[model samples]
Target: MSRIVVIGGTGYAGSHIAREAVSRGHEVTVISRQAPDAPLDGAQYVQGSVLDLDALGDVFDGADAVVSALSPRGDMENEVIGALRGLIKRLAGTPSRLGVVGGAGGSLVAPGGPRLFDQGFPEEYKHEAQVGIDSLELLQQTDDLEWFFIHPAEVFGPWVEGERTGRYRDGGDVLVRDADGNSTISGADFAIAVVDEIEQPKHRNDRFAVGY
Candidate 1:
């Protein structure tokens, strides 16, 4: 079984990922500043902050894959880039693959043109979106790191939390939309794609988009 480590695992997206990984028989470790309110059956929850470089840097040594699901909000607003840069340094040259769960703001609404963040994205979320955009740029330039980033559908978050259907589509480098032009994916189903990538190793050194 793969040894998967998920940073920010107690959070909405991270917890779903950790749950899926555990269900797949992988040895899963969840890292967050606080323990989960209700931990998963087969996952191990570790209390720690991603900002704790010295401590967090040591958690991924033997992991098969490390997924980062950190959100750029609250006290972490405008600070996720630093944590990600730290992870890039710490994970470079390691056997583990690094996976980043990015926001849809960085995804192209239509390929080869303006990004979603540039297309009149909500100002309230601009700061968080900027971090995601910057993080994708940072990952693209890291030639030494075995990294893959996943941008979830546009209408994602707890407010619209959907159910798992064990299904999703991957739109590489662009946003995935339905016939109605709606881009959305259930968190559980999105987690399936994340864990599937971890187990199967597709999209190496690149990013992929996920949606229904």
Candidate 2:
């Protein structure tokens, strides 16, 4: 089993990824400021923030792969980017692969087109979502790490835990929509997609989207 470290592993997306990874028999380490209530079986928990590079650096030791599920809110004047920059630098010249859980705001609706955040997204979440978009932008510019950013569809969160059909439509630089002309997926399905990306390295140095 591969040793996987998930930064921000206590959040909505991170916790799901941790659970899915453990179910796959992979050794998982979760790094976050707080631990989850019902932690996944067969997984290690480390308390730390992604903004703290030094503290976060220790968790990466001997790790085969790392996943960033860090979502920074507020003014975007934080160290989320700084922490990722450090991760890229530390992973440089190493064999560690990176998988990022990006927000839907960064996912495009068309080829080489504007992101959903740029279009008619929610007003309340516009700022934070844009920050997420910017974070993906930073990840895109990082040539140091072998990484792929996975963006989920519009309807993803704790409310919906999709059934494990292991069936999902993947697309690059374009949104995947259902027959009703809506782009969406459950959090569980998105978790499956994230783990699939970890097992099969696709869309390296680029972003991809998933939907039901």
Candidate 3:
């Protein structure tokens, strides 16, 4: 049972990951701005924002792994990358591996081709996509820290509510799609992929995608 800390454990992706980790018998701690209306069983919920360096450091200390599922919104619109930098600094020389929930915007639409964001993605989501892109670029520049970024398919979220098949596919930067040329995965199954990676430590210091 490894000690795991999820930075935005109450959010859509974060909450699912937290639940999956708890179900796996890991010591799970979720740090969020506000408590969840209904919390997960056998998980500790800590009320705090990711922007709080001191609080984040406290929660990150002594953990086997840290999953950063933070998303950009409102006041945090431009602060995601900065917060990640701070988190990386805090984890310096620690044994904890950082796992980031990345966006498809930074992923390649085709093998060795242009990124999804470069292909003129929807303007409404451009801001968030760019943040993810920047986060990946920043991670690439860092050295000596163990980190892994997991990018889900183009169609994945709470709205999608995909069913968990307990089976999914993993890939590199190239986006994974089905035979019909569709890319999607359920939140539950995506959580499964993440927890599997956390336990097995595949794709270390690298990025990968999950889809079905």
Candidate 4:
């Protein structure tokens, strides 16, 4: 089994990812400043902050992949980018892959055209969306790093936590939407996509979108 570590494993997205990886029999380690309300049975949880990656000690050692499910909100609104920069540096020459879970704000509404963010995104979410956009740009500039960024559907969040259908589609840099213009995916299915990529990666040094 691959050893996987999630930086914000106590959060909504990170927790789902940790659960999925562990269910798949992967050795999973979760690191977060806060403890999970209900920890997964098969996952290892560690208290740590992504802002201080250096102080995390050997938490990432021998990991097959490290996913940053951290969000730029609350006290962390201004810290995600800086922490990501440090993370990239640490995994720069290593064999472990770095995967970032970003918002759909950066995804193109249409190929070679306007981004979802530029199309008048909600004011309240603008800041967090901008951080995701910036994170994508940061990864793109890292030529020597083995990294991949994933943008979830526009309606993804804990409030809309749907069931796992064991199905999802990759939009490859473009936002995914159905016929009625609904763009969404269940948290569990999204986690499935994440772990599937971890096991057999396809979007190396690239960004992709996942949706129903």
Candidate number achieving the greatest TM-score relative to the actual structure: 4
List the candidate 1 regions with Cα displacement exceeding 4 Å. Answer: none
Which ranges in model 4 have alpha carbons more than 4 Å from their true place? Answer: none
Per-residue accuracy of model 4 over 1-212 as CA lDDT, tens digit each: 99999989988899999999999999999999988889899899899897787788999889989999999988999999999999999888888999999999999998885899999899999999999999989998996679989999999999999999999999998999998999999999999999999998999999899998
**What TM-score should be assigned to candidate 2?**
0.91
State which candidate, 3 or 4, has the greater lDDT. 4
Candidate 3, 1-212: lDDT as tens digits? 99999988998899989999999999999998897999999999899887787864477778999999999987888889999998888886889999999888888888896998888799998999988888888888878689999999999998999787998898688888999989898888999999999999889889998898
Residue-level lDDT of model 1, residues 1-212, one tens digit each, is: 99999999988899999999888899998999986779899988778887886875567879999999999888888679999998888888889899999999989988795788889999988888888889989999998879899999999989999999999999998899999999999999999999999888889999999998
Query: What TM-score would candidate 3 get against the native?
Result: 0.97
- Model 4 per-residue lDDT at 124: 96
Q: What is the alpha-carbon lDDT of model 1 when measured against the actual structure?
A: 0.90
Highest lDDT, which number?
A: 4
Q: What is the lDDT of residue 156 in candidate 1?
A: 92
- Model 2, range 47-93, lDDT digits (tens) per residue? 87766667655678778889988776543246567777777887876
Better of 1 and 4 by TM-score: 4
